[model samples]
Target: MKVLYNHEYPRRVRLAAIGCGGHAIRNVFSTHPYAPIDLVAVCDLDRERAEHTGCMFGAKAAYTDYHEMLEREKPEAVTVVTNYDEDGRPRYPQIAIDCMQAGAHVWIEKPPAASSAEVLDMMRVSEATGKFVAVGFKKMFFPANVKAREIITRPAFGSISTITARYPEALPPLEDRQDLHKMWRFLDHIVHPWSVLQYLAGPAESIFVQRSPTGGTVTAIQFASGAVGSLHLDRGQGSSSFLERTEIVGPGGNVVIHNNTKLTFYSDGPKPAGGYGRSGDYYGGDERAALHWEPEFSLGQLYNKGIFLLGYAPEIRYFCQCVLDDTPPEVGTLDNALEMLRIYEAYCQPDGQHIRIDTEPGKVS
Candidate 1:
């Protein structure tokens, strides 16, 4: 629990970065100051972007070739924030495997790979090299999601029975499922909610989908924990609508997260002394009342920033901490990514198709 200031951590993890795109610039680079990492070099295929980002982020070196940068800088870890290939497959799986082989742990961006098979390949490399790899599944680290997890795991919350999550994205028509480019948006975005669901509910056992003409999808999921869940992919919603909502139900209690910011938890409580008809006020005592949390915007605190509030900084911090602690990441690991990919595969198939998710070899039911 030692908080390392950026200037004071003289022995922080030596790190290199391999992208200078918009996400890298806005979220990834800005997060290193809050992590136990000293970025030593920045790399991108575009040399100009590499140098500019290096200068902006206080990296001492820049390179157009990541292989050369990995060899020369020898960072303890590297962040791969690059994008997809021409064929719409992510570039990070190969880059991560190479980084691990080069003796550096790796943190890669979401949609870890095009498929579960690719994620499994990266998992194999991680095992062989003994270097940990993690994907930035930021939603699982969001304050609201974190709080929901805390609430549901409490002994008083009873056994979790159901979950419902909503996210804004469109799954392409069935005809386009085979086209990687056509399905690119779905692949890139589905990981956000899938990560959150698996984080709270564990691995899913079976899945079925129902799609609408407007390109939205509602997936019915059955988790291994005997939990039933629904994922609503909200496409064509108004541009001004705030984006996500989630609710989880246990025995006599429930937790809800709205727009990824507000969290409200309702606990099991006795009825008002008389009855619903006799109660004069709606207020329940503190012990039985709902608990609510949302940030106040008046303070200029670090926690008020979107990077921190929405989870980018915390996710990066978690990755760096695991590297410093010499432990495999407990969350956001390759195994987690593999489970998410199985969910993604379920979506690629038509409704009513029975898809059994395989969490381990010979483990599917």
Candidate 2:
């Protein structure tokens, strides 16, 4: 709970950043104030952008070449928030591998790689170098997701049996799946919901997708834990509409998250006194009734800020915590990123054709 200013945490992990784009400026760099990190350097292909981000984010130096920055700064860790390459592959996997080879732990934004194979390669390098590589699967760290996890994992919720998520994203035609450029949108944003789903329900054992004429698709999933799940891709929704919704159901209880912030947990409702129609009251006591949470704009609190509420700061804090504790990250590890890639791949398959995924730990090969 200690909020240490960047300058006040000189003894914290010496860290540098690669990519001075909008996501880094708005979400990642702003988190330096709270995380256990020293913003020592910033790097980007564009010198002006890199220099400006360095000055803006309290970094001591800036460089055009990430290789030079990594070698010269010798930072204990590096954060990468770069975009995709010209071919539409995420630039992070290779850059992350390079950072680990340079003896620095890495935190990169998703999608971690263009394909599961690339993630597997990153995993090999991370293992060989003994440096941790964490992806910024920020949705998994959202306050709502964290609370839903807490609710479902609790003894009162019994065993989680089903999950349903609705997200606004389009699925490219199957013919274009192999072309990275054609599938860029699918590869990029699909990780958001898939990461959250995997966080709550370990991994999907089998998946079957149904496509729509409007480009959206609905996917049915069977989790490894005997849980059935569904992901509805609503590409036709208006931009003003809420983009994400998730519901996790267990024995006699359920949790629902709407628009990524508002959460309602309906704990087991009272049993019917005699028959279903014989119940006298619909509401339970305050403690037994559903609980709801959302940020109030009236308060000038950090929790009200999107950087925190959207989970950017906490994700950075978790990465810093892994470095300080000398432990590999549990949530955003390369393994989880690989799983996300597999899910994306499954969506690209022919509609209604179930694809079996290998969720077991280790490299895909």
Local error of candidate 1 at 308, Å? 0.6
Error of 1 at 160 (Å): 0.7
Q: Best lDDT goes to which candidate?
A: 1
lDDT of model number 2 = 0.87
Quantify all predictions' global Cα lDDT against the true fold: 0.88, 0.87
By summed lDDT, which 10 consecutive residues of candidate 1 come out lowest?
356-365
Per-model TM-score, in order, reads: 0.96, 0.96
**Candidate 1 ranges beyond 4 A from true positions:** 1-3, 361-365
Please, what are the lDDT tens digits per residue for candidate 2 over residues 113-198? 98888888988998899999999999888988998898899998988899999998898877888899999888888998898889
Can you write out model 1's per-residue Cα lDDT over 1-365, one digit (the tens) per residue? Answer: 24456777656889999999999999988887788788899998898988889999999999999999999989999999988899999998999999999999999999899888888788888878899898999998898898899899999897799999999998888899978999999999999989999999988899888888989888899999999999999888899998999999999699999999999999888756667688876766767898899998999777788898879999898888899888999888888888888878878887767788886731211
Candidate 2 residue pairs in clash (backbone atoms < 3 Å):
none
Looking at model 1, residue 342 earns an lDDT score of 80
